[model samples]
Target: MMNNKKPEVWLRGELPGISTLLQPAAHALLQSKEEVFKYTEGFPEFLLWKRPAGRASVGFHLQHITGVLDRMLTYAEEQQLSEKQFEYLRNEGAEIPEIKIDHLTQAFTEKVAQAIDIFKNTAEEKLTQKRTVGRKQLPSSLIGLYFHAAEHSQRHIGQMLVTISVLRNQNN
Candidate 1:
């Protein structure tokens, strides 16, 4: 029997220029990018909007992964939503017929790239700086926000994988 697990990203080594304080978040982001595409590959396009037992559609999970990363990383910057970012947030799971899986994945990949840039430049001292979240003005530190971003992204990735497994298995 073959052992199929790939080595975890954190074990692979240090990421150069990414702040040591932000290392775990960087690893999580890189790992998230890999696992998301693996689970979503060749997922039936016809069922992109289909949900099992009224759970979120695969498309929504895909979109949410990207949108949440964008929003959370923005908050980590001590910023509020931009008009366009707000617009994206407002439509997190709305089903649009013409959108394809690649579009969502592409958006997510781009967001991860931007997030890495943010991680690279964030000062070590700023990890403890306070920031606000959402319109509710909930308080969080820079490190808290980064931790949440990593966890939240993985949370949605788990949801996406479960949804994909359900859908794909049903098809098979």
Candidate 2:
């Protein structure tokens, strides 16, 4: 007879509601950060901004993702965010730096690691508490915020790939 009891698992000193799902999602997001850097290797900064007129350069999209992740991490840690970042969190269109492709890649990697470390060290129970991020109220659960970060990162990664391909084609 098969046992009906659920297997016990823990992360960050607490058991995640869906530990199995969260672990792999976190790993995949981390991998994507590396992949984005690898994808743009040796590419010229000019190409990062050489998109069709009225379109955001690949650089802008990447920087946006970095800012978003940083914002979420700040909220998760209950830390104060920059005045600019706070405005961005409240509004849809926020100004972010025009990051060079290479530098943005490095920044993304570093931010990802920092966010992951914060998430990993947080206790399981703490993951669910709601925290005020900047001025926007958000649920305190780290898991939810982690998921948001991963999904947001993935979306930008996809955009970066498309932008790169378009720029490469334009070059040829």
Candidate 3:
């Protein structure tokens, strides 16, 4: 069911409550979630933190995906990052023995669900509304943040896939 042979997500037609312009972002996020879940299956715990060829670890990608989504969505809502969330961001790649691949993947899955819930409540008209991001207060539209969140999540998933491949190949 997770094969890439299926049609691209954006062509699947409208998702019920997401704005028309925002549907592609939502679909990409959902597909990324599924692909990550599949890609991570049976991923070895011992290799979770391996920085193959000086690349970011699979663990980092997993943590960053969820953290970035939460932060981006918070920016979209016109809110500053909370103290706990900032701490979370700072600790993304710490090598904790207990942090297995499944734990990280499940965290991402939950974050994806949270993102979908927010997408449902977002007004179609708010897509163009400007929002301030982070301490620098960089300008961005609501749709931009969500779109970035989707693309960023997929980007990390791609990196994780490469890391997994490298790790597996090294083991063989």
Candidate 4:
């Protein structure tokens, strides 16, 4: 049977307002949001923190994706991370019983939207402008930060899928 699912975000054509240079990064963020929701549908809250085979938990990936995107975008804007952002980073992946999968997924979705908005507003000429990351202030560029946010999100999403699959199979 022919596949009835919609094409991936990158295949769906350019997003309005995003620069051509930043289209791929925007697409990746959009795809990451979709995959997070798709894979986490009906995922048990209790399993969110399960670390099968000592790999990172699904909860960690969800939180990290949101946190990292926020941080990367902040750096892209050439600003220091707020105290709240730093606190969030420190708490990522902690087994907070009150936090649900839906909450985490929604946060990730919102972060992606925020990133897209930033991408849309970013001028093409500034993509190569220098930026620094973290306490050590490692050198980077605007485009570098955006691309890292996208690719890093995808990497964690892959890890999350694996963790979810392992947890589900074990529970089943």
Candidate 5:
């Protein structure tokens, strides 16, 4: 007989207990994986869809999600993002140049790994620090960064999925 065990859900809907500072990061990391899987599943070959009418391909969007996570991680660490990162957001492409589908997937994976490490290693005191993005500023608490990363990925993942569907239909 085949084993039929189901995968356990990785995140909780309710807020974490007051004692845990890293829970938000943990939650966001899980959500990121879900988003990545949703966007990339069914047709890996479809990642090649770069529309003449659109800005970037599905691969570029994948790279962008990781790129934004890296920015949020910088904010979590109380470090201002560099001009290069700002340029990436404004320009809308890979921060790490010459990115292919494999490279984007790797970058996204690395971002998640870094996120987990930061959450695990950071002191509670550091989590309460302030972070700024140009004129807008917010506390660097785990919740803030966690929601930021997750919500940002959610928005982009939706875009990518829709784009993938359109591209797949167009190509066929």
Candidate 6:
């Protein structure tokens, strides 16, 4: 066996356009994207919305991670969530008819790409600027929002993986 697997994104050296300060966040987001695709590969669509032990379903996790990235990045840019974003947030985990595993995974992939682009455009100075989150307008720094988005994605990825494993085992 060749045993060939690439190191996690952070260990692969700095991404070209992402600032050093934002590298960890970027790396985490990229790693989350990779893991989402890897773990969800060939996962049966029938189990996508199945929840065991009242925990969130794999479908919800996928939708949530993507939605959080969008909302968090928007806050990082010192903006409020748009109507569409709010609607997406409200719908995060709701089962949809005929949704496939790949559809959810691809949406997450695209959201991660968009997040990276935002990271590249964000100047280092802006990272420390004040920002507000949600309608409550609670205080946070720009960097805080970005980092939260990354870590939040990682959190959901872990939950999603566990859900997937349990679901598969149950079906078997």
In candidate 1, position 135 carries an lDDT of 92
Model 4: runs farther than 4 Å from truth? Answer: none
Order the candidates by TM-score, highest first: 4, 6, 1, 3, 2, 5
lDDT of 2 by residue, 8-40 (tens): 212233324335445754665676686686678
What would the TM-scores of all predictions be? 0.93, 0.73, 0.93, 0.97, 0.70, 0.97
> Model 5 segments beyond 4 Å from truth?
1-8, 11-21, 34-38, 41-49, 52-56, 94-98, 124-126, 135-142
Better of 1 and 2 by lDDT: 1
lDDT ranking from best to worst?
A: 4, 6, 3, 1, 2, 5
Per residue, candidate 6 scores C-alpha lDDT tens digits across 1-172 of: 7969999989999999989999999999999999998999889888998989999999999999999998998887778989999899888889996777888889989999999998999899989999999899999999999999999999999999999999999999
TM-score for candidate 3: 0.93
- Per-residue error for 34 in candidate 3, Å, reads 0.6
| Candidate 3 lDDT by residue in tens digits, 1-172 | 6776776667778888877787888998998998887888888888999899999998999999999999998998899999999999999998988888888888988989999888899888989999989999999999999999999998888888999998999998
Compose the digit string of candidate 4's lDDT tens values, residues 100-124: 9989989988999889988889999
lDDT of 5 by residue, 23-135 (tens): 65566566666667656766555345474366566766786788788888777666777988877767555334455566666778888877767666667776555566443
Output the number of the lDDT-best candidate: 4
CA deviation > 4 Å runs, candidate 2: 1-21, 84-99, 138-140
Per-residue lDDT for 1-172 in model 1, tens only? 9998888889889999988889999999888998878888888889999989899988998888888888888898778899999888778788898899999889889999999998988889989999999899998998988888888888888998899999888999
Candidate 3 positional error at 59, Å = 0.5
Clashes in each model (backbone N, CA, C under 3 Å)?
Answer: 0, 4, 0, 0, 0, 0
Pairing residues by index, what is the TM-score of model 5? 0.70
User: Model 6's lDDT to the true fold?
Assistant: 0.92
How good is model 4 by TM-score? 0.97
- What RMSD does model 6 have? 0.9
Worst 10 residues of 2 by lDDT: 6-15
lDDT of 5 at 57: 69
Assess the local accuracy of residue 76 in candidate 2 as a C-alpha lDDT between 0 and 100: 71
Q: In candidate 3, which residue ranges exceed 4 Å CA deviation?
A: 1-6
